[model samples]
Structures are given as structure tokens and as C-alpha cells.
Target chain A: MLKIDNLSVKYQDGNQVLRGLSLSIENGETVGLIGANGAGKSTLLMTLVGILLPLEGTIEIDGLLQDKKNLRELRERIGVVFQNPDDQLFMSSVYDDIAFGLRNYGMSEENIKHKIDYIMKELGVEKLQNMSSHKLSGGEKRIIAIATILVMEPSVIVFDEPSSFLDPKTRRRLIHLLRNVPMTKLIATHDLDMALELCDRVIVLKDGQVYAQGNAKDILTNQKLLEEAGLELPFCLQRIEL
Target chain B: MSEIKKSINRISNLEELTYRDTVIHRLPPVIKLLMTVIFLVTVISFGSEQVSGLFPFLLYPVLLMTVAEIPMRPLLTRLLIALPFTLFAGLSNMFFSKEAAMMLGGIIITKGMLVFVSILIKTILSVMSVLILVSTTSMNDLLYAMLYLHIPTIIVLQIMMTFRYLSVLAGEISVMYHAYILRAPREKGIKLIDMGPFLGQLIIRSFDRADRIYHAMKCRGFEGGVIFSEHKKVRTTHWLGLMIVSVVLLILRFVNLSELIGQLVIG
Candidate 1:
């Protein structure tokens, strides 16, 4: 379980990106964080991962309060897929990229090999293991990026924006991937359809504040509240025309 | 995401250089580095009077750079920057040497030219060898080679860290330069005074970025010492390539083919 309390972040420019936001995710739960541009979604994720420091707040992952000293272990336990896949995929080969995190954690060579192969196979991306990252298509790049973090075997997975730039087919595949991926997930995205399809619960952020939170269907189908928060209900939320 | 894309572009560009299936490109960097040192030593040991002898030694670096596909024009341009300083020293010799002490066309021409040539060749070979090494091997591999060559771990780590931050710093500098271009009038070249402030801002931002990177690396469990997870076996072809190059360079140091060709051309 991950719990964030009264979290706030402000840049040197004095722009507050996250405003006293509080949220929680239970074990094995899939939570979607919805917000428009500049709504502090990415900042919130970064703060949770310890990439960005919060001005005021407490983050507890699995009953242990988060602090700078134990940040390495915390980050190890929480696999974060950044909004941009390219920033994190820094190795020459796909195999090397996937094994990067594991190696950083000091995993044995044999175990690194076993885990990398196993994760790639599990993700249905074994064929791409030798392919250069630059050559991969957009959808393939996204999948490979996720695989890089997933191979680290974190207990919690946080995706900054998984559905961006993907075609409908790839988006559907990603939703399916997320649904089947074991471990707790906190996904921050603007795609309401993805949220409705994959998240068990939803948290709405507006101007860096949590505007609403509830079961996925209930929050997603509420046209009035979503509209006020600069969000629109997913097409799936609409009743049949007939 | 755009930032990430830029980094991916940087990484891809780095890998493309090493894709050649050549024996020289595959040699362990330490061996290649040692050989380059030897070449430099031989080139430097030539007597100041023997300009003809040094010409043969010139073939060593020239062939390497040509085979390595390093464009000579730019390399020469960089080497030429040092010529002005050498000319300053050579000019003093020309003006201040006593008539009895200086041989006609011997002391001023031979000794001065040789010293200048020696420095120029050393500078070019050093830079060219580094360029060749980096072009043919990944930065991580080069770092490993440095470690194997018994370089200080702290220095290697510093180099690796500096490299990691270089891209970040480059991006920041590019952004600042772009902003300056956008706001400043094109007719007046960037004001000389503005450069100071611009660079000052860049250094401050770079330090902040470095701090962030350090934290990020720490969070990702980066220990002080670098770890190469997999060990690759050294192949025989890598050794053979080194031996061949070394032999050819050694053979050329004594040859007067350049003088013979010059005479033939003159005839």
C-alpha cells in the first residue's frame, strides 16, 4: 500500500505544481490519476518516486515512511515508467536496457540473464531483445520501456502516461497489459477511456489539487463533475442510444 | 517526452559509430591506447635535424585516421590552432640566435620546424587516437579499458560522471543559445558582454542539474565504483589487428619513401 498525505510541490519559479494533495492505493489495486495539462499529475508521480522533493508531505510505502536516506530502496521497490520512454532507455541493446536496473541493484550475472529473458518472454517482446531501441515503432518503444522497469521486479508500478501517442490497437494492448500485470499500479493519464477500462479507482487532480476520488465507473460516468474539473466522461461511460 | 527523445537520439548516434565489423574497432582499448603511446614516443624521439625521418613516422597516425574514417580536414584544422603559439617560439629563434651559433637553414629551419612539427603531430595523434577509441567503442567500454590500464578509479568515475552530465549540460546550453538568438537582433552579433551573463547562468543551472542527476543516480543505487555486469572474452582477431598495425608503424619509422617520392616528383 502507498499513502501520500498533504503533499505539495513548488518550483523555483514559484509555480505550485502539486497542492496539498492526499491519496492512497491499497495492495493490488489499480488507481488512475486524471488531470489536464499542468494539473500536476507528473509532478505528483515524480515526488512519490523521490525524483522531485515535496515541499510538505509524508509518503509511506508499505507502512515505511519515505525519506531521502532510504530513497534508493524505495525507488527499487516502486518501478516508475516515466512519461517519456526515451529518457530511461539509455543502453545500446534492448537486452542491456532491460538488464540495466537489475544490474544497478547488484543482481548476479546469471540471475540478470534469467530475469531479463523471463520478463521479455512474459511481455511478448522476446523478439525485440536484440533490436536497437531507435528502430522500434512508437508502440514497441512504449512496451519496451515498461519492460525495462518491469524486469526490476518492483512491488509497485507507476506509469506517468502510458496511453499517449499510441494507436487504438496499441492502446487496447497496453490496457490489457496493465490489467494482467501483477502488483499495485498508480497510473497518471488524461485518457478517461483507459482509466475506466483499467483502473479500479480514480483520483481527479485539478490545478494540483485532488478534486474527486471514487470507484472507476462512478467517477468516470459522472459527466457534471468531470466537466467542472476540465474532464470528459469516456465513451464507454455513455448509455446506449437505443 | 521530447527530452527523452533527444536523449535517445544522442544514444543512437553513439552506437552507430561502433557498428563496423573491423579488427581494429574490436581491439581492447588498453592495447590500442598503449600502441598509440608507443607511436607518439617514436615520433617524438626523432632528432630535431631529421625532418625527413619524422615524415615516415607521420604515416602511422595518418593511415590510422584514414582507415578509421576520421575526416582529416577538421582534424588538421584543430591542429592548426596550436601553430600560432609554436610560430611565436620559432620566430624568437629566428630573430635572437647569434650568427655563429645558428647554422644557415639548419638551426632556424630544421630545429624550429621539427619542434613545431613534433608538437603538432603529438597533439593530432593524441586527439585522433582518443576520437578513434571513442568512435569504435562505447564510453562504458572505454571506462573499463581505463580501469584495466590501472588508471585511478576516482578519475575514471569523475570522467564517467562528467560524460553523463555532458548531455544534460549540452541541452541546457543549446536552449540558452536558442533563446539568445531568438531575442537578440541578428544584425548585431551576440553582444560580447551578454556572453558572460549567459555563461554564468548556464554554470549555475548546470550545478543544479548536476545535483539532481547525483540524487537520481543515488536513488537508482549507483555505487561509487562502476560495475560491468557481463564479461566478454577477448578474441584473437583483436590481438592480430594490433600486431599488424604495430609492425607496419615500426617498419615506416626508418623508411625514406617520402624523400624518394619528393625527389621523383621534383625530377
Candidate 2:
């Protein structure tokens, strides 16, 4: 399980962003992280990745605590896919980017190639292996980004706005892809419909604290709670009500 | 703004050229890097009056361009961009070295003119070899070669990151300039007074982007000073190629092949 206990973070300007936010994700579970513009979703993701060390909180994954000493090992257990695929796909080619983490751990070339080939095949992006990551289309880039993370084989994966730049066809394709992933997933997104389809449970954030948490159906359908959190019901849910 | 866009395209075009597969392109990067260094050092060692000997070195870039399918036009065009500097250095030789060197086809060629020609030849040979190296080798392979040479990994990573994001930086400049123009239509160029804020904004934007990129890299288990490119093993053919090329270049550097060929033709 991935756990964040009473996590609080402050920006350089001294504004508190994530105020005592705590959540836990069980292994093989899909949890939705929904929030308004300044509800600290991005901040929480940054904290999870160890980019911004919390002023006071503890991040635990599996049997390890996130700290200066265990950071490198902890990064292997929890993978983060940032908001921009461009940022994550920094290496020259898709193949290189996918092999980056494994290479960092000093894996042999033969083994790296084996792992990368398998992951690319799994993502159905084998043809894109040699292509420049910068030249890929939005959907293709998104898939490659996912491949980069999945090749690491993390115990838990966190995604920030996975469906943002994709078209409808691509978004549906992504939804399908996310459904097939077996590891624990925390998807922070405003695409409530996708959250409803992919997540078994949902955590709503308001003022950098957990506003509500429960079954996806119960929490997503609770109209008043969503309103207080500065959110609305998924369009699909509204259509069914009509 | 258009210049920045053109620059972005040029960077992409140069990168695209490295994807071509050829025997020269397939050679391990370290051997190629060594051969280039040998070529450059030999070219630089030629004395000012040895213009005739320098003619044989042209064969290297010509053969490379033909075999690798690289166009000469773009390389020469890029050469033109550096012409002013080389041209200045060569022309100054005309003023200092005043001696009658030889007579060519009923005209006297001064030593200064000969020196000028030699300097120009040296510049062309040096620049062409480097450009061909870049056009044929992928950036990652070249960086790996640098690592093989024992360059510090941090420096290599810095170079790789800079080369990778140059176009992105150019794109950012274009967008920011466009937005600035839209906001200040009446101003012609940026006013001196607003320059501080304008440049300050660019710095801030770059910092934010860099911070995000660093975070992304860290998330991928990138500890500082670690290079991910695999070290390619050099094959026998690669070693033989490097040996033969170095010997030929050294021979050309020492022997006046131009004079020997002329003698053979006369006999």
C-alpha cells in the first residue's frame, strides 16, 4: 500500500498548499483524486514524487519510508507520470526513454532490451520504438509516456491529468489501457466520467484536505458534497438522471 | 519570430539527418570520434605554405558525403556562416607576409596569397569533418563516446540536455515574443524600460519549466551523474578502419602527395 499521513506542504512564498492531507491506496486498487483548481492536487503529486519534501508528513510505500536515504529505492516502487508527456519523455528516442530507469540501475544492455521490447509490445507501441519522442502525436506521446513508467514495473503509479490533450477516440483508448493495468493506481483528474469508469474508490479534496472519500458510486453521486468541493457530477451521471 | 521558427526547423533537420543508416553511420562512435580528432590535428599541423599538400585531405569529406548520402550544399551553406571569421583571419596574412613565393601561369603568387589560401583550406577541412561527424552520428551515441573517453558524466549529461532542449527553448522564445507583441502593439521592438521585466519573465518561465523537467527526471530514478546509454563494443572492422584512416592521414600530412602525383604525370 501507498500511504501519505497528515501531509502538509508550503510554497516558497509561504502559502500552505497541501494542508494535512492524508490518503492511502491499497495494492491492485484504482483510486480517483478529484479537486478544484487550487485544491492542491498538483502539490500532492509533487510531494509523492519527492520533488517537494513535506514540512510535516510521512510517505510510506510497501515496507519503506520516503526520506533522503530511501529516495532512490522508493522511486522504484512508486512511478509518477507528470501532467506533460513532453516532460517525462526527455530522452532522444522512445526506446532510450523506456530503458532509462533500468539503465540507471546498471542493468545489462541485453536485459534492458528484453524489458523494453516486452513493455513496448504490451503497449502496442513497438513500431514507435525508434521514433523521436518529440515527433510523436499527442496520443502516441501519451502512450510512450505510459510505457516509460510501466517499464519500471512500479508497485504503484500516479498519473496527473492523463486525458487532457487526447481526442475522444484517444481518450477512450486510454481509458481502456488504464483499465488493463493491474498495479495500484492514483489518477488525479477532472475527467469524472473516466474516474467513474476506472476508479473503484474516489477521494475528493477541498482546501487541501480530504473533503470526502468512499465508494466511487456513492461519492460521485453525492451532488451536495461535490458542490461544496467546487466540482460537479460527471456528465454521464447527469444524462442518466435526465 | 520567423528567424526563431527557422532555427527550430534547422535543429530538427540536423537531428533528422542522423537517422540515416550507412556504413560510416554504423561505425562505433568512439572510433569515429578518434578518427575525427586525428583528421583535425593533422589539418591544423599543416604549415602556411603547404597549400599543395592540403589538397589530398579534401578526399575524406568528399568520400564521407558520398557514402553517407549527406548533401554538400547545406554543409557549405553552414560554412558560409563562418566565412567572415575565417576570411578575416586569412586576409590579414596578405598584409604581413610579403615575399614572392612562385609564378603560376605567368602571374606571380606572393607568399601572403599562398598563406591566405592555406588558411582557408585548413578551415574548410576542419569544419567539414566536424559537421559530417554530427550528421552521421546520433547525439546519444556521440555522448556515449564522450563517456568512453572518460569525460565526466555530469558534463556529458549537461551537453546532452542542452542539445535536446534547444528547439524547445527556441519555441518558448517565439511564443513569448509573440505574446509580448500582441500586448504592446504600439511599441517598436521592446522599450528599454520594459526590457528588464520582459527578460525577467523569460527567466522565470525557463526556471519553472526546468524545475518540472528535473522533477520528471528524478521520478524516473535519475540520480545525478548517471549515464544511461549502453557502451557499444568495437568490432575488428571498426578498429581496422580506424588504423587505416589514421595511417593514411598521417602519410598525407608528412608526404607531398600533390608533388609526387605531378611528377608521375610529367614522367
Candidate 3:
């Protein structure tokens, strides 16, 4: 469904973040991208959405290349949930935020309203339909952020740090939601346990390169590989088997 | 901390009031916006010495507020914040112009005082009318009205994004203020020496936030232009309300209602 070939991204001041990294994900697969801070996970996500032009290499989404000419169409097929819900939820009300993409696509108001109602109800945020973004709690904001993406009905969804700042119950709910979503999901997170619970495959990133890639359970259990990538084993797997 | 919280609450309270169901709230946003513009123009067009002429204009806001079922306290509080600048301008007129314009029971009313009062009345009436429009109409509706009026899409988007960012920026500033106070409990506010770094940090943080927001917007397929759904047609009642209110405003603008009432009562 998605392909990246020798992708290398750099900042304006000559700081290379992602260097010659290449990977591909098949349709209907869940992949987790895990690494320490500044692992280029965000850069990769932004590049895929055409927000940041990669320095070298090509990104193809459903056979459409990521470029200025194809950005609008490419973005239509990909939904992104930003790390900070504040950034994603820019509309005055939750309903508007969820309907933003639909409006951009020129959907009828009736259709937009129907989709928004269904999405908000599915996320159990119906009561917050009219609430302002800033007034919501962290968990509520996160759920609303997800709804904003989900309402777009994109074929692929990219999530950046979806579990951060959420309480345990809300975290569990998120895990459940991510596990059940049938679309192609590329989640970048530090929550190893969540990745283990939701991702079918795991890709470990270290210093702008793919250090390791394998099945989610196997990659997660490799303590030596994780430590080398500046990560740690999930808490549940931290102890040695007696 | 309390001050910041109060200001945040003040904004949300005003926003909440817009959702209340009432006749005025149900009026089309374009109509309310047009009424506000017409009211402001009429209030400002009066002669600088015609304070009594402006007195009748207060009815517009008062009637709208009553019908809208909006409380006056929040609107008045916001108006108070805007008064000082106008008050200062009026005070300058008091000091500069001293020609006597009227007499009442041996007391002189200078032309300066008349102008001052007129300015004050104009400020109050204009601000209150806008407050009524805002309190009764949601920001979403107002933006739609702007789009319906054929305002440029970029300008409308700028307004919407700026308003959304205002509270976000304010919340950030509030947190920074609390952190400052917590560290230097002996100080009232950031010291003048600290203002450089204090404000610098805010700008940097705001820039970073804006960058992320731009990326988020782009990811949602925002491509410079915004599309709005078709607006509802302006109805008969809207036309009638506009005509009646406008005619009354014109008559009051030309003929002082307060003087006519006094003449009839005291004759």
C-alpha cells in the first residue's frame, strides 16, 4: 500500500534526520515505528503527507508518488493524527474539525453532517460535538483528534505518539480502537506495550536508519536490539523467565 | 493563575452564550452582522456634540440583548476593558475645548463636555452592539456569513485561525506566568530585565506551535482555499427587521429623540 525508496530527509541547516532509509508495507497491515526521541519518525510521517519534501528518494502511496502535483490527491488517501491534539484540532468545535477534510473534498453539508455524527458517536464523543478544542481534557482531545482523521475515511492512517499524555483507561481504549481499525496504520510511539498489543509488525529506527525489522512480538522481545536502538523492552517483558 | 483562569473562563462563557436558543440567536448571521455594521455607522455619524442623539441608539443593543436572553454582565465586562482608550481621548477633549454649549441651573456645560459625552456614548453603543452580535451568533456562523458576503477566502481563514490560536497562545502564556510566579514568589510579574527572555520564549514557542499547526492543516488537504456550504436565504422577517431598525436609526440620527421626549413631557 505504501513504499519508500532510499528516503533521506534533511533540515534547512544541513542536519540529516532520515538517511537512506527504505521500507515498504503491504495492504491492511499494522506497522509500528519505534525509537528514542528525535528518531525521525515524525519527519518520515510528514514527508509521507507531502508536508516536508524529502531530500532524496521517492514515496509512493497506492501507486501515487508524493510530490507537489499529487499532494492533494495523496493527502486524500492518507490521514494523520499529530502528536499534539492542539495542533490537529484547529477548528472552533469538534464537529467542524471532524468535517474539515470532508468540506475540503466538497462534500454536501448533509453528507458531512451524517459522517461527523457517525464518527463522533463511534468514538463516544457525541456530547463533545460543540465543545471548543482548548476546553477539552487530554484524553478527549486525543479521541477527537482520532475522530478528525477517521472521519476522512482515508485508506491509510498515520499516528504520532497516540498514547502520550493519556491516563491508563484512556490508553486502554486507544489500544482497543487501534487494534480493531482495519485500515493500514503506521503508528510511531514510545509506548512499546501499545505497539506490541496493536501492531502486526514492528520496525526499529535508530539514528535515521532502519536498525531492525521483523514480527512485532519477536522485535519487541529482542532486548539487545532494542537497547542498541536506544529503546528498552516493554515493562511486561523486562523480567527474565525463571 | 486565577487571573489567567478567569480570562479563559470569560472567553468560553461568551462562546457558550452564543449557543443559547432565542429569537435573536436564530436570526441569520448575515442579518445580525449587517445590523451591527449599520448600528455602528449610525452611532458614529452623529455630530460630536450630539450625545442625546446617541442615547436612543442604546435601544438597539438593549432590545437585542433582551430578546436574545443574553446576560449583560459579561458583555459589560468586556466593554469595560475597551473603555479606557476612548475615555482617554474624551478626556483630552475636556482639557482642550472649553466653549460653553449649554446651561443647566446655573451650571455650565462646555462644548468639550458635550463632545466627551458623545464620544463615550458612541463608544458604549458601538461596542455593545458588536457584543450583542457576537454573544448571539457563533463564530462558525459569523465566518460563514463572511464567506457568504464574498470576503476573500484567505482573509476569512486568517481570521478563523487567529481566533483559534488566541486562546491557545493565551493558555501557553498563562502556564509560563504561573511558572515564573512559582519560581520567584517575591515578584509580582516578570521583571523588566526578564521580559526579554520571557517574551522571547513565548514567540519561539508560538512559532513552533504554528509550524506544527500548518503541517496538520496541510495533512487535512487544506490547499490555500476554504469551501463553505451554501447559505440559507435571507427571510421576510430579516428584511422587515432590517428596514425598521434602519429607518429608526436614520430618524434618530437626524432628529434628537431625547429632546423631543423632553419637550413633550415638560410642555
Interface RMSD of each: 3.5, 1.7, 1.8
lDDT (tens digit, per residue) of candidate 3 on B1-267: 368777877887788888789988888899888888888998888889988777777888888889999998999999999899999999999999999999978999999999899989888988898888889887878888998888988899888778878877887788889999899999988899999999999999888888888888888888766544445578998989889988988898899899999899999
Per-model C-alpha lDDT, please? Answer: 0.74, 0.87, 0.88
Q: What level of docking quality does candidate 2 show?
A: medium
**Model 3, residue pairs in steric clash:** none
CA lDDT for candidate 3: 0.88
DockQ value of candidate 3: 0.60
* Model 2 lDDT per residue over A106-175, tens place: 7888989999989888888899887777778999999988988888899999999999999999999999
TM-score of chain A of 2: 0.97
Give the higher-TM-score candidate: 1 or 3: 3
Binned by DockQ into CAPRI classes (incorrect, acceptable, medium, high), candidate 1 is acceptable
Order of candidates by TM-score, top first?
A: 3, 2, 1
Model 3 chain A: lowest-lDDT 10 consecutive positions: A90-99
Best-performing candidate as measured by TM-score: 3
**How far out, in Å, is residue B242 in model 1?**
7.9
Fnat value of model 2: 0.67
Per-candidate fnat, comma-separated = 0.31, 0.67, 0.69
TM-score of chain A of each: 0.96, 0.97, 0.97
- Candidate 1 at B51: error in angstroms? 3.0
